[model samples]
Target: MLDSLSLDEFGLWAWWIIAAVLGILELIVPGIFFIWLAAAAAVVALVAMAVDIPLTLQVALFAVLSVIAVWTSRRYFARHEVPSDHPLLNQRARTYVGRNYTLELAIRNGRGKIRIGDTLWLVEGPDLPAGATVHVTGVDDDVLKVEAVH
Candidate 1:
């Protein structure tokens, strides 16, 4: 069936179909990467329709455009990182930093547990007794590093 179509017609259809497939893949995967490739393919489709370029040149143009699109996206994202008022919003333990809490469990050998907002957090700090006031200083994985408030 494809033998009936000329090179330009085939190139146009091929690029457009590839573009559509890439676009759908981008939606399914949600990586924000394939959309650029789809755009490049669509641009090539337009070029293929308007020009009678050789197949090799068309492939080269598509590759170049895709690379440029990906590079530009990377650079743009690098310069414009997503900024938020709460950088630690997703880090539940980090959010406790600088907050004072009473130790529910005594620190034996620099480890203890504290109750904060109905959650028990494992903490590391200088040895202290239960009921001692401690301030969260940093977070290490699921554990919080704390210091005596006094």
Candidate 2:
């Protein structure tokens, strides 16, 4: 079976098979990276079928096309970054910013606790009584920075 296949036929088949494998890998381990390489391989396969190009030239074409595709994609993504509406979706603590909460514990020495959405969060701010209202100004890791809501 191996002897029956000519060099040109083998080269064309190899390019197509590699492209298919890369495409499948992209689906399994999705990072939007391998798909570009697969596209480059497909282009080389088409070129190989049209004209009898040398193995070195075919490999070089694949490499050059892959680099061009990857560079173009990076530039596109950098220029057209889609801002998420819920910027604080993963950072639950940051979402508390601008919201008002009453201190459940007295803020002595710039530390206190407040109840927000069934969770008690440690807060940092000026000293205040237990029942005083505070405004969430920002978040620092697990702690929420607050100011007294006069």
Candidate 3:
């Protein structure tokens, strides 16, 4: 069965198979990545079927089409970003910004702790006695940078 078709016919079939494989991989993967490659392969297969191009030209065509497709997709996605309802969903410390809380421990040497809900978060601020009110200014790593609420 393999010996019947010419080399050009075999190359055309190969490109079609490559396109199908890439399409299947796109479904298995997470993002919109492999689909573009699959499209490129399909286009190359169609071109090869219509014209008697050599293997080198077919390969070059696939490369050019893939680059253009991927680049255009990236640019489109960058321009149209999906907005989220919860902006600070995973940012625990950033949620505390602009919020005020009473310090449970006195800040000595610009280091102290504060109890927010069930968590005791480390804070860095000016030296103040226990029970001093502090405002969360920003977050620096795991530590919350606070200032005296005055």
Quote the lDDT for 4 in model 3: 82
Question: What lDDT tens digits, residue by residue, belong to model 2 across residues 1-150?
Answer: 887875467657999998999999999995799999999999999998999889989999999999999999989989999798988788988877999999999999999999987888999999999999999999888999999987
For model 2, what is the error of residue 24's alpha carbon versus the real structure, in angstroms, after optimal superposition? 2.0
My TM-score estimates for the predictions, one after another, are 0.72, 0.72, 0.64
How does model 2 fare in lDDT? 0.92
Model 3 per-residue lDDT tens digits across residues 26-108? 99999999999999999999998999889989999999999999999999989998798998888999999999998988999
Off by over 4 Å in 2: 1-9, 100-105, 114-120, 130-133, 140-142
Task: Give Cα distance to truth, residue 40, candidate 2, Å.
Answer: 1.1
* lDDT scores of the candidates, listed in order: 0.92, 0.92, 0.92
What value does the lDDT take at residue 104 in candidate 1? Answer: 96
